[model samples]
Target chain A: MKGSSPLVRPGAPGRAGGPDTTRQAGHRATGTGSRRAARSERLAPYVLVAPAVLIILGLRLYPLILGVNFSFTGDGDRNGMVVGLDNYLELADDPLFRTALGNVGLLVLLLPVAVAIPGLLATFIYLRVPGHRVFRSVYFFPAVLSPVIVGSIFNLMLAFDGPLNTVLGTIGIGPVDWLGDPGVTMFTVVGVHVWATFGMALVVFLAGFSTLDSSLLDAAQMDGASLARTIWHVVIPSLSRTIAFVLVTTMIGMLTSMFGLLYVMTSGGPEGSTYLPEYYIWIQQGQMNRPALASAASTVLFLIMLVVGLAQVGLLRRAGRQD
Target chain B: MKQRTLWSAVLVAGLTVSGCGSATRTAPSPAGSGTSSKLVVWDWKSGDATAASYIEKAKADFAKKHPDVTVEFVAQPFDQYYTLLGTAIQSSTGPDVMLFNGGGQLRDRVDALLPIDEYVAEDRQRLAGWDAFSKDGKVYAAPVTLQGHPIYYNKEVYEKAGLDPAKPPATWDELMTDCAAVKKAGKSCFALGNKEGFGIQFFLSGLGSGVLTPQEYDDWIAGKRDWTSPHVKQIFTLWKDVNDKGYNNPGANSTAMFNDSWAIFQSGKAANVIGLMSDIGHWKDFGEFLPPDKIGVMPAPVVTDGATPSLAYDGGIGYGVAKWTKDPKLAADLVRSLTSTEALTAFYAKAGAIASDTTIDASQSGPAAGAIVSAIKGGKPALHVALSSKTLDLMGRVSQKLLSGSLTVDKAMDQMAAADKAS
Candidate 1:
């Protein structure tokens, strides 16, 4: 009865009366199998994410490295040959590129306004203002539209002879060349960009509002706090992280995502006053056959975004700590 | 033919698969070594509704010559055509034949193209505007359409201004007087759009003949441009003067030269526009809004003494075989079919282009087209076309600045001279 039992199998490792050679072989096999299982368990996370990591490396990082390398090479007759900072020197001398960089600075200065409109709108919605549901949907509507469509629609609305000017004329106000004035065109484009994209930021803010401890807002109200005071004291601190996220994102959007609008409306014109780095890169690479110069411009843009993003994060963290 | 069709199916399948990969990963065999049954072409026009019949006629002509060979025309967006072509060139894989704008666009990328002069020798006598598609006496592409800047005036506006519509201005003074009358009639003297900087191109070329001595005009086209010359400065100064005197449509800096400026002229808001002989801003397009007889074509008014006015035209667009093609002869044959008289006549009829084929009858298009045709013999290469792409681009920007009063003509002339010299 003992020999027929499963536990009494002769070759099982660590059995009380097993033979030495067979038992030793079984013990080694068990050790090897357990070690293999442990190693496989250790590798599971990486194995699960291998495809994604590979994809990111191949598609994003590899091309980025290639592009940075390409920036140092020559274009046209000297193509594929290393030129050692010649493209960067050329970019420095280009007035159009300089205008583009200046526009980037303008965008950075305007970032707070871009973030605040949505924050305020989300606060109003969260407060259950009149027709809050309708306002939420209405505000989010523009975000769903393609930039090309928005740009085209605005082009019609903002032209010198367009409906906007006509309305201004009826109001006894002088008509303004919204898209024509070099001094005003970049502001006009940024204004439109803010309008179109503020919806997405508002949604992010509303989500942040959902996580906010409503008790603090209620406490402020109970203390006879004014709406402005409550927002400045309680709500701003509560949504500090959200504001930081929105600020960095909005800045990135302005720097990178204005190409479609720029392409459709003004085309970086009015004496190159509306030029952005992306549009400048496109013009150099596509129109002027200076891909290396475009690459240099692109690298500069990337560096600007990096520095600005890191600075914003550091500033926001310090502000949050003070709060 | 069935085998050719099967081969076409395979080629399409191959292209579809290859298109999914990076251009470098799927480099196709050159036409000289690959199967000759299928030829791929890239153009901005083939997809246009107007170019349908022209494409069909050309396809039929090509089919007659190589009945066993299949042709695939890939229509690309004009805005991104050159960019995409550059990518293909860098990867060493693309269409067998591609379309190019005749001047700087073609010249800037000649290394990617095969010279078709030997193949198109038979076409020399028949085609006009060959010089535009030629560089250093070697033709790279076959001319398809003739493009020129023609001053188009609205007869109705001229009549409203109490001027003879039949007789347009013949000198700078006459133009100014006509413009004054137009302003009095509450209409703009010119429909101008400098948004994309193309308005300046039309302006310089349209009025160049009027301001420059005939010798200077020829010299400029012959690559001896003197950007600092007094006549050159006058063109920029007069451009600013027109805007300063309220002779152009308001917000000239914002309006696009394409349909926007054309719309101003068509809507009777402006008396005249320096327009094109072919493409969107031509007499045919203007005729769409105004009656054909209401549009009048006139030479540029003389702005300087000893200046002789004539049309400024060149090859508008053309098709060339790529150097990497396995069968240059077959691709060149496709180019020939694309430029054939029958196909061009269809193109002219359907697309309203001034066909590059000189023998094609254009009298039926309109009197404006007729006038353009008559002036062809005296026409010269466009002044702006003579400048390098860099200079042309700078000129466009400065022209906008000049109109905005942010830049001076002297400063613009200096910048232009420097850019030209650099090129």
Candidate 2:
């Protein structure tokens, strides 16, 4: 620990050879020592990158490639045999799968709403509103909960004769079928998911807010600029990268991680109206026992995620440039 | 340092995002069964308190035959049972023996099982409803419990509605009239939960006998299903009609059938429910909520004028040997022991199953059990149970849509017919 400090510090000497043999700077720069030094310098980048590169190849890229390959196979009687897109052909004809894809489109349309909720809250917190610390903790508590717990809590609240209906009835509003109606179940599930997860995005936005320049806000207030104008002209341009990160993460969260909520809340029910690709893959692979067909659905989901992620990055970068 | 931390964070997040990938997982390698000391069994029952004694009895029975062989029972959660089984099937190596629900679920996965007809020849006459676990006349699993759809009436609701519980409806018109009276008294006639699509299966099997002509009932079970038949269409029509007429509890489309629909009946919110004969949502569960006398089991009311009503039942659950087992004879022996009279008797006594063993003393189980046992003699294989898993799955969604008035009965029936033909 004593001598190695200089070894890691850039431009530091004393990282030569055995003990005091080549510790002398004049000896280290001669013949074979210089060649070894050059070689180690060349190897530094690879050493730094090894862990992250191996993790991505092993965990992310490998499973994705494996999933796409498996989509060509057959299930049941034809277990291991490759059928070459028979599963995709079947998915095209299936209405339930189509509904799942349609729900993905619905999620895309609601992306802005999900991002804005947390973005606005972060701003309020950044402004140091009354009891901000307490509000931050209370708002972020739901994000710490597992979706199963959240979904179960919402399931009790959203029952037909549950407290929500009772409260609505007291206010002279007609009882809305939160989960029983085919058209309403998907929205109810998505609303619960957003409620449960927005805190994560809120925390991220707060971190971005911490890095914001205080002088710009002070000048805006002095100039009699409205809160909306300040956020639009200053905060938006400064935090574009953070907003982009939140948008991509939130979209991915909706697509991949809402399975637990969908599973518990509506179970893609009220006549299969809430079938997301993630849940559709579950049904095909688990309930329907069509693992091969599930793979095809998964491959399509992967492609959708790729397109959506790239679009987000592109859109955010362009907006940042314009600013 | 910041760049490295960011890369680590991004990679960790990437790894955490997962979905149900269709890629088959590597299955546990097959355990050599010939002279092997261990035999593992997979089921959703062994962990259940009531089913524990049954498992013990079954293991003892098997132990008598193979004194040195040991047994292992792995109980899976009921909800995730099939998915786990599907995973095991794909890998070609799982448990030496497994439990299966009787119908299309068993039929669809027969390739993974060893047909035990030769091993169980002696027990054939004692047990009933073997057809439910068979495909093309070859038995895939032995019947342990008889599951059926019986009309269980809440006599408290009937009495409250100013009707005699003793005289449950004898015809469709009478049932509707009673439902109207119940509604007038601020109660629903039926407690239906179609959320998982199982409510429709119970409905189809429960009321189908009263709707289809006796010939059509036999034909439907015999693989000669006539989707275009008016009587068949009437089953789906009556399903929607009851819900539309406010005969069922509100939110029937959203309610889950597992115990929620049964809860409505138990709480006396409904007059009757087309419920299971075994396991749950039966006389035993309802007996706890209502007095024993108030829990009445009645035959389905007549829907079609000329139709002869009969109890609709089949093998409920059974034990099957895996195809990869090294010793077929030993695994089959284990299946036989699992369904043995002594084992099934303990199952019935503690679990309240209407055991497949016809000789079991069910007289002590009360009048409701007696009625179900007597009905089994005339009962046909359930109409819904006869359909393949694919068809049953399709029927559930279609039935839900039919209840919501999104799809017509004819259109649903057409889809079911197409699925049936393909399967």
For model 2, what is the error of residue A8's alpha carbon versus the real structure, in angstroms, after optimal superposition?
11
Q: Tell me the RMSD of model 2 versus the true structure.
A: 6.0
> For candidate 1 chain B, which ten residues in a row score worst on lDDT?
B1-10
Provide the clash count, candidate 2.
Answer: 0
Query: How does residue B95 of candidate 2 score in lDDT?
Result: 81
lDDT of 2 by residue, A75-122 (tens): 878888999989999999999899999999999899999999999999
TM-score for each candidate, following the candidate numbering: 0.88, 0.85
User: Candidate 1 DockQ score?
Assistant: 0.35
Docking class of 1: acceptable
The runs of at least 3 residues in candidate 2 whose Cα sits more than 4 Å from the true structure, single-residue gaps closed, are: A1-60, A77-81, A124-134, A210-241, A315-323, B1-40, B64-69, B74-96, B322-330
- Give the CA lDDT, 0 to 100, for residue B244 in model 1: 98
- Which is the leading candidate under DockQ? 1
Error of 1 at B374 (Å): 1.2
- Quote model 2's TM-score for chain B: 0.86
Query: A1-323 in candidate 1: lDDT tens per residue?
Result: 22233433332334323334544777876666655654555555567667877866765566667778999999988999999999999999988999999998899899989999999999999999999999999999999999999999999999889999999999999989999899999999999999999999999999999999999988999999999999999999888888888887898788768999999998998888999888998788767888888888878877777787779779778766765
